[model samples]
Target: MKKILLLFILISSVSFGQKKLDKLLNKFNKNNVPYISVDSLASTKAILLDAREEKEFKVSHLEDAILVGFDHFEIAQTIAKLPTDKNAKIVVYCSLGIRSEIVADKLIKEGYTNVFNLYGGIFEWKNKDHQVIDTLGSNTEKVHTFNKDWSKWLKKGKKIY
Candidate 1:
């Protein structure tokens, strides 16, 4: 009986762990990320972070978003550069929302008061017909298409570039 209960708990935890992110995402404004929209993001003074690789980031990214590239070194530098306000609002996103989710958890653990993970990352934003500005070598907003066939679930509506 104890073994059965343990197994059930394990299964429940595994099944529901991701849902925590859903709630976290909803705690902020909406439209772009799950919890926060682009307009809301613009108005709420949240810091935007793009966790993609440097090469991919060079292709395109959200306007005014800081690039951290999901590496330990990059994350450290990014954190160091952040303002001293522990309660500042932060929005982190990566391709398909995986890395951003992980980063959000890390931020929370590190004493950040308000953190949000963009639910679908830039992929969903473009699909929703939202604009994405790029800030890198060239300052041009490009359509952030998920360049893979399996990404169909991410693209729901119009495309942007």
Candidate 2:
């Protein structure tokens, strides 16, 4: 009985401690940061970034989103291609919400004033029935489901090929 109780407490603490990402997401949502749907952002002056790898992004991505993987060693070099306005609204997203938050934090640290993490990442955006365009400007009309491939190794977004 003691062992069972200890295991439960351990699990709870780990989950509770890991809520950092969730907290950041909640704060962003509560603050009412401007969220640009892929379509809306495509129409607006805002910058949409896919914090995923080049190969994965090549598979499919919002037409206007710049591909910049968070784990890449030289992220700042990649960031240089973006708009120079530090206050310009930038939306960062990946397969799931984890890496996006990290990237958003880094952007803020790098002097970006208005950085936002897409709460649900691309999955949530697609799940909301939003359209994800392909590289060639054709409406692919399908979610970039990360599915089990991501679930296995990435342990984040789902895989949908």
Candidate 3:
């Protein structure tokens, strides 16, 4: 009975936390671009794009994720990196998905039909135990949280500023 109670409590807390995150994302994102969950992304072969700054990306990123940068994002440069097929699946992510929405929108404007914003971004990816790689392509738990304020979202992994 004690074990069941503990399990229920743990499940409840996790669910509550996810609800809070959903509320936060809803507040910031325009919802113009569709969001793909971390689990959903894991089973797919999309082109992963990191929308964070170069410094943040160096700390850790999803495997095969290309850094496109958010602050100085250039459509021309980004397009050059993308495949000629506009329908190709592309997923953009940042610390917590806010910045990625902006980047995803840009891709849509540029005629990419299959662009998706990572629902909870890198923070969620690491929170879900997905592997992240450092600059050397070695798996690491360290993730750039963007700032101390945003670091709270990361439930697992070594938080890097």
Candidate 4:
């Protein structure tokens, strides 16, 4: 119960923007890497990496999330763009977390000591009521689903295919 209360406080403190996050975390935290809950990550300081394609990122992405294109993902090339310290906190996410998991694994293999994969990716980020922005760098509800089949997971906002 103590853990629950502490979580509540953290949630309240980072309650920035319109993220709903009402969906049980258990439902979406089903990932390979030790998952980072959206609320938990939101309240912490870390490098948020977007592991989607360039086109997908243009649709919308988490505030301050650095784009690292997945389809053409290259780990060595990404290193230069990464924080100079390999031990720095890093959280990666893709449209649905699959790609991010791969990216996170690569980061770990490349000597990164603290790498975490965002639980559900941009879909969850938008669904939870967190904010995202467009290619123009303007705040928008639009999110790219990668396809019609994937769009179903997005429970909120304008779905940009």
Candidate 1 lDDT (Cα, 0 to 1): 0.64
Ranking by lDDT: 3, 4, 1, 2
What is candidate 3's lDDT per residue for 8-110, written digit by digit as tens? 9999998999999989999998999999999999999999999999999999999999999999999999999999999999999999999999999999999
Clash count of each predicted structure: 9, 5, 0, 6
Report model 3's TM-score to 2 decimal places.
Answer: 0.97
Q: What is the C-alpha RMSD of each candidate to the true structure, in Å?
A: 11.7, 9.6, 0.8, 7.1
Give the runs in model 2 whose Cα sits over 4 Å from its true position.
Answer: 1-45, 142-144, 147-161
- In model 3, which regions exceed 4 Å deviation? none
- After aligning candidate 3 to the native by TM-score, how far in Å is the CA of 109 from where it should be? 1.1
**The 10-residue segment with the lowest total lDDT in model 4:** 16-25
Model 3 score (lDDT):
0.95
lDDT of 4 by residue, 10-112 (tens): 7885463224332433444444466787888879999988999988898899888888888889887888888889999999999767778888888998999
| 3 or 4, greater by lDDT | 3
Write model 2 residue lDDT over 1-161, tens digit each, in one string: 99999999989964664374357456644433334444554455667778877666766666688887866835567568767888888888886565666777777778888887665577655544565666676655444555545342222223445
Tell me the lDDT of candidate 2. 0.64
TM-score of each: 0.64, 0.63, 0.97, 0.79
